[model samples]
Structure formats: structure tokens, C-alpha cells
Target: MKKLYFLIFTFSFLGYITEAQQLLRGPYQQKKTPNSMNIRWRTADSLDAKVYYGTDLNNLNLTATVSTLENDHDVELKNLSPYTKYFYKIESGGNVLSGPDTAHWFRTAPVAGTVQPIRVWATGDFGKGNDGQRLTRDAYLNYSKDKETDVWIWLGDNAYQDGADSDYQAKVFEQYYAYGDIFKFMHFYPSPGNHDYNSVCGIPCQQDPRQHKGPYYSIITAPQQGEAGGEPSTLENYYSFDYGNAHFISLNSELGSPTAAYDWIGAYTNGASTSPMIQWLKDDLSKNTQPWVIAYWHQPPYTKGSHDSDLFYEIYMKAIREKITPILEQYGVDLVVNGHSHAFERSYLLKGLTGTAATFNAQTNVVNGTSGKESLGEAYIKYTDGTKPNEGTVYVVCGNSGSDVAANKALFYNGSPHPAMFYWDGGTGVCGSFIIDIDGNKLTGRYLTSNNVVKDEFTIKKQSVTGIKNINSITSSISDAKVFPNPFAKNATLSFTLSKPMALNIELFSTDGKMSRVLSNSSFNEGEHSIEINSDALHLSKGEYIVKINEGKSASFERLFKVD
Candidate 1:
């Protein structure tokens, strides 16, 4: 009787262990577009999958109306809202799994030219199971907690050892879930890496069917021809979209060539330049007047890290120089963000090939000076005079999300072939992320360490648009002005040009039309005089404020901003 009891007890204990091991959660992968977001997870056995979501976390009144999809471990929830947050959960079988029950949240991106900031968390090579990975995850979560992050950009090599689904769950998902609350919110935007392709070599027993797809996909963030909000592709791995004052073009670095991605980008860029998207971006920028045009992909155009500037990938870079970057520059593009290197590095406003020197002449300056509502001219201007022109595109390498083995410390130094503004070895911990604040004409970026420290910081100012007062060339006694850093935090500088010197008065008012402070009351010179306004002294909070600048009765420009 005692022997039989012992056998039963052992069997029951083993069964419980198996069931506990099978529980699925953590490491949510890939959410795209305006309306719908997809959720991919795993379970130990065949079980019913359901997601409970709503605007209110306490009262998740809205559940996935459709029947739960069974058998498959991955599930996608569709028909969501743009720029709205939804709380969700996953259930296995009929039981609401408790361990993985942490509420997952996602915010849809606004349509093109909406003027809202498009926030993304980017990191690369972060699949190793180490302290660095944990630090990266923690920092990402900390930022997400404070900011409204629309998506998480994974530059590649998301899982180490092998890219098998199981390894992804163990190393990537489980390790991520170690901090369940922080990551439950943002959805992942992933790219492929060399290690991800090595599943065949490392995982003998496991065969992932998605290998052929290479985990490559594209997402559009606005309403489109075939779909309502936007859609994700299962076809070719690359696609493009227009989102809130920018045209986002994502490519497949591992599978496709520059030729294919270039053609696709050309069509999209040309269309955006002429289509309603252009007007929207223009209006968005006009209202917000944020000084940044941004783009992201898995590979870096310039890097001093483990992967030297890839000449093969340079073909794509050249294409961008010829087609895409020109358009962005024409539209006053401020930044281009990328990851692939296993460290964080930032570049100066660079132009041309490495080691090229050139001069800045009048014609060159005029050509580069062309701003808002102009066509991005031919490539000759960018690569002319044997030097690369700074059309104000700052390339950044933020691939140090978690995975850092064989990291190159030399890349961080000034003597490197491609010098970066900053670099970090794996010793400091693996994961780190960047936060960008786009307030009016200035774009400020903060690089946070794994422990939530601001490791590096930089700011890019928007170039003042010239020739606005050239309208006076056609009409005498005309009026115009400009205010910068519209979303002024502590202070903002306002500058304007006049046909002739005139006395000017500037009044800053709250959104409710209450006068807050007077920026300038003295008569100023005519060329271009900047007046600084201190916001904090006015005792105002973050919201839209109006700036009315008046020069006698003939000149004025009304601008608005959300103070931070």
C-alpha cells in the first residue's frame, strides 16, 4: 500500500511541473499599423487563446468578440483604434492563466501628418541571457512607463544561440517576463539577424516553419487602399507608410537588395511628396513645426562597430543618398535612426563618403538652404564638390538593446574609420534605449542606461526657413515672423526677419487666451533678432500656448505650442 501511494504522489507532482512549465506569457512580438495589433505567444499544450482588452484597465468590458482561435500558439487581435490604448490578456483553455495575466497594452499610431510624436524603442543584438539583457529590458520598461511608446524596434538578433521559437521563449520571452509589469505595454517591431538564421545548426530537434519567412514583414500606419486602418504584410518583407509628419520606409536588410527596396521607396516617397500625405505632413509641421524627419531600419549607414560600413549595404545607402535622403532633406529631415551594431553610437551631421573634404559655396548653401514646400533636388548637390553635404541628417546607431558578444570597443574612439559620438562595451550591462522629445523646432534625445540613468544626451535645432519675407519682393509693407521650439519647456527663442527695421511687441498667452508674459517690448533690428521667453517663470503647465508677435500694425505671426 505504501509503495502504490508513493507512485501516485510522484506522478501527480510531475504533472503539475509540466503544466507549470507550459504556461505562456512575456516577450510580446510585433504590433503594427493604426487599428490592429497582433499578439504572439506559446503554450505547453493545445489550448484556447483569448485576449481581454478595453480602455479602462479596471473594467475590461470589451473582450475579443470573435471566438478564440485554438491549436495555434500564436494569435492576432484585430480591429483596434488609432492612437488609443487597449489593455489585454491571454487565456489558455477555459482557465484564465494567472502567471501570464499581467495586462499588456499597446497604442496605435496616428495617421500621416497628425502632428503627434511617433515614439519607438529601438535596440539590437539583445538575445543573450545575461545581465545586459535584463538591464536593457528594465530601461525600456522604465521609459515606456513614462512615455507613450507606439512600438518597440528590434534591430535584429533578438534571440541568441538559435532563433528557434523555443529558444526565443526561453531566452527572450522568459527573461523579459522576469519584469512582467514593465514590458506588458509596448509591442515589438522586430528584424532578422545572422544568428536568427542559425536555428538549423543549433536546434537539431526543433524546426521552425517561419524560418523561410525570415521573420520579415512590413506595416503601414494609416488608412490604405486595401485595408481600413493599415495592415501587415506576409508577402515580400519590405513596405513603406506615411505617419504623422513623416514617411516611414522599412526594408529587409537580410533578404532583399537595394534595388527592390529602392524602387518601393521611390514610389512611396514620390507619392507622399504630392499626395494628401504631403499636405498633412506640411500642416503638421506647420502647426507643430517640429524640426525632425526620421527613418529606421535594421542596418546602419555608418558604423565603427563590429560590422564596418557595409559596402554592399552602402548600395542601399547610395540609393538613399540619391532618392530617399534627398526627399527627407528637401523636407528638412533632422534625423535618421538605425541599429545593427552591438553598441550605441551617434554621428555628426555627416555628408559624403568617409574622409572626403569639400567647400561650402554660395550656390551650394542656397541649394541646401531650400526648405518647406520644395522638391528634394537631384543627387549632384549631396555628393557634389567631392564632399558629402550635410542636409541635416544625423545618423544614429542604437543597436545596444541587449545582445553584445564580441563587442568592438575601438568603435567608440575618434580614430575609428567611422567615428561615433558615443559607444559602450558590454561591461556596463547589455540593454539600453533612447527617448526623443520633438517639441517644435528642437529635437532632444536622451539615451538611458539599463539602470534608467541618462547616459548620453543631445539636441538638434531646426534650421530657420529663409525667403519667407521674400514675399515683400512682390508686395511692399508686408508682415511675417517665426517662433521656434514651439513646444517650449523652460525657454523658447523667437526670431523674425523684416523688409525694414520696425518696433515689435510680442505677447505670450495661455491656451485660454490669458496673457502669460511679454517676450519682447523693445524695437529690434531688421535682419534677424531672436528674443528668449522664460516659460517656467510664467507658472504654466504643458499644453498649447499662443504666441502673438506684432510689429506696429503691418507684421505678425501667431504660433502655438505644448509646453513641457
Candidate 2:
């Protein structure tokens, strides 16, 4: 009888083991650096947490095991290879929960300041858990099928109604799982909006950001220690990161003063704020060496979409415009993206207009007055040289990803679109998202509607020609001269064909016209000739530089982009 009882108990335990723990939240990725990654998930029950990962799906040779048995799993895989693809699977209680399939893989970030093509998908107010949300996601997936998305940026209101954990579970995480494998693959950087703040500090949300804690704070794992680059902010509400040849700043407009009893202006005031966030911003910007700088947050400095920036009650928008924009411009920030308005709106290259929409003067504020469309031969060009300091910044309002914007017309000041906006949806009933593609010195942004139609597109190109004096004076001898890798790392090969044996002088200069290096000062043969430009010998930094090849009477200027 004892043997029979023991056999029955063993069978019961084996049956229980066969049942798997269900995943509740995410298998999402965060804080992705070239050498490290953070993966988090939630299960229905407490169980031993483990992540099996490797470069090959068939052979997951590495295991990151957690000692504690908990429902929430947060695993950090460190000392990883840069720009490598790794396949992984989640396991709990010794049972495989997710997968080691093709869908369960992530590409690590490349070395910072590497000049590589990167694609970013950005959307705002997309946590509705409705058909609109599903369609918008589907459109991005369909459009980006051929290309892998490197980064996903959220423009707040990630969850609808309220920013509760339950709302995020239903509308954000579960919805991504239901729609596609976005959470499983792409890593995201998020900024909180007023709706997200509502769940953190209640309605009319006002609280010390230093002491703030809630679902939004707990769910995200941003880099607060400068591991991914930039000076450490030590605050999750706002931080900075460097990827490839670009720098990204994620700011929080929902934060409030740490000292004040009830003041909600956290990031900055009309001029400067007592808040530390502004100080951190200055420090981060001053330390940034990347050529392309893009900053994003919740409230826009200029918009006429779902929200009116002209209203005095719109304090958040006003503060960003009057207080924050001057600082960004001072640092030569290329782009500022925001989402509080529910319609798509894009501004011309602008600067020095801090007042209301009525105070906007095109003659004084508009930098590049032409439409920034490359096909129209009006692509905005920014020179890194001191010749064009604070050229301009392009502002975008892309908050209609999942939310309806029918009520935007009611808030438009004087029932007219803000004059600052060069392009806007203007209530065409278009629901969509945007994409940013960066390659070398050029960046192109496109707005794609739910139907996968390209509605608006613009391009920004960074060029350097400061030291090229009298470049158009003459032309001779030099033919088919070009840099094999214009945007290169380590070393670059400069090849040219000379019409005759002539003395050549090659020199490199920084964007500010400072001499960087004297590459060649000798005569080349008449036929094809090549010279290797080494980064080590030149001590090159990641930025734009001009190379001048002088042949006595004729000179040729070529731009070179050096990456670390």
C-alpha cells in the first residue's frame, strides 16, 4: 500500500511539471548597449528565472540564471559582442516559456559613433488597444518588412484612460504581442505624457520628480548611469544615449519642481529653471561629440494640432518653447520631436521665435524658408562650421498614431493652423506614424499613413566646407577624385586620377576651419593613385571635416565624415 501511494504522488507531481507558467507581461528589451542588454518579463506565478541566449538559435550555448524564484523576471546579459545578433528564450521553473525561434532574436547596438544606416520607428498616443492602434502597428510592420527597425521611440500616452499597470498590460504589452513580435525584437525608448503622469500622481499631476514613483517609473529601465553614453543624469525622467553617429535625448515634460510645494514646471522655465534637469541637459549637450543631435519629449515647443501652443493655459507647451528651445538651439540641436497634439504637423527650419504664434516673423525666424523636400531640390543643409551657428531646428508633432484628432479643430487658435507649421495633416482623417533614417551626414524622415502611404517627407544633410577658400576659382588635373568610404572608421582610401604628373597638397580641416592634419604634400604620378587616411595617426574624432586637395592653381574640396 505504501509503494502504491508513493507512485500516485510521483505521477501527480510529474503532471504538474508538464503545465507551463503563463507569461503575463513582456519579453521586452531595454537599456540596450553594444555590450549589454536588459530583458524583462512577468509570469503568472513565482518561478526560477532563466534566459538562454547565443548567437545561433540552434545552439543557445549561454545561460543567464537568476537565483530567486519570482513572477517578474528582469535579466541583464552583459559582455556581449557589439553589432551582433543573438537568439534567446525565456524559461521559468525549468520550463521554456518563450522561444529560441527566428522571431526571438535581437541585434545588439553597434559601437557608438559608428557610421551605419539606422532606421527608427516613432509613434505617439498609441496605447489605445483599439483597431486604430492595431492598424498603425500593422502599417509600420508592413512598411519595415524588408528593413529591421533599430529603435522604437514612444511619445507618451502609451496607455489610454489612465497610466495604470493594468492599462499598460492590456493596451501596451499584450497588444504588441497580439499584433506582432515588436516587443520581442525591437528595443524602445519612452517619454511620459500627461496621461502617463495621471496614474503616477493623480489628475492635474504635480509632484517632485525626484520622489515620484508609480507604474510608469517601475515599468521602464532607462540608462541613468551614462552606460550608453553622455553624462549621467541619474534620473529616468530625462536621459541621453548615443547610437551609431547620432545622439538622442529623451526629456520629460511632466516633471515638477523638487523644492516647490506645488510647482509643476520641472524641465525649465521661460529662461532657466532651478530644476536640475536643465543642468543635466546642458552637461549632456556640452559633452556630446556626435554630429547629429535629436531630442524628443512629450510637449512640443510649437504646434497647432490637437493642442494649441498659443494658449496661456497650455503652460507645458509654453514653457518648452520659451524656456527650453533656446538652450537646444544654442547647442546646435538638429531636430526636436514632440507629441501632445493629436495631428501630424511639421515646421520649417526655424529659430529665435519664442513668443506666441502671432509673434512669429518668417523674415527673422525662418532659417531655410524652402520646403525641406529633397525631390523638390530644397533639402535643408546645416553646416557644422561656425559660419552657420544655430542654423535652425525642425519640430514635428506626431501624436495621432492611435488617438482621434477630430477635436483638434476646436482648439486651433482662431480656427487656423499655427503659422509656424510648414506641413500639417489639416484634419484629413489620416492616422499614421513616422520613420527616421540616418546614413552618414544625411537624415530623412517620412510620415506614413495607416494605409502605408507616404504623406510627408523631409531630409537634413550635414556638410562641411569652411576651409575651402576660392574652391570655384579653377579646375584642372584632378579627375574622378573621391573617398572610397566617405563616412568611414579606422581608415579611409582616397583615390584620384591625374591628367599629368603634378604636385599635390592635401590637408584636412575641422568644420570650424581649424587644421586637423596634413595628409599629403608630395607629387603624385599621372595615372591612378591612392592614399590611405588613418584615423589613429590623425587622432580623428567623430564629426565632419573638409579635405582640400590643392594643385597650385586648382583646388578640390571634399567632405569626410569620421566615425569612432
Best-matching candidate per lDDT = 2
lDDT by residue (1-564, candidate 1, tens digit) is 999999999998886777556666542534455676665555667766666667776766655533454443445557777777777666666544432333466666665456665565666777776777787777666666766665455566667765776656566666443333445666654555546656432211122222443322222121233132222333233334444554443443443222322233222224223333223334433333322346566656566565555444344333333444444455545666766676677654444422211232222222222111112211111211111122445667776676543533534443454533333433334457666655444456667778788766666544322212311111133233445554355876766666676676777765344456777787666576667766667666654454556555333434434333
* Residue 147 C-alpha lDDT in model 2: 93
**Candidate 2, clashing residue pairs?**
none
Estimate the lDDT of model 1: 0.50
lDDT: worst 10-residue window of model 2: 262-271
Q: How do the residues 12-75 of candidate 2 rate in per-residue lDDT, one tens digit apiece?
A: 8775655443677778898989999988888888887889999989999998988798888889
Q: Report each candidate's C-alpha RMSD, comma-separated, in the order given.
A: 11.3, 12.2
TM-score to native of every candidate shown: 0.59, 0.78
What would you estimate as the lDDT of candidate 2? 0.79
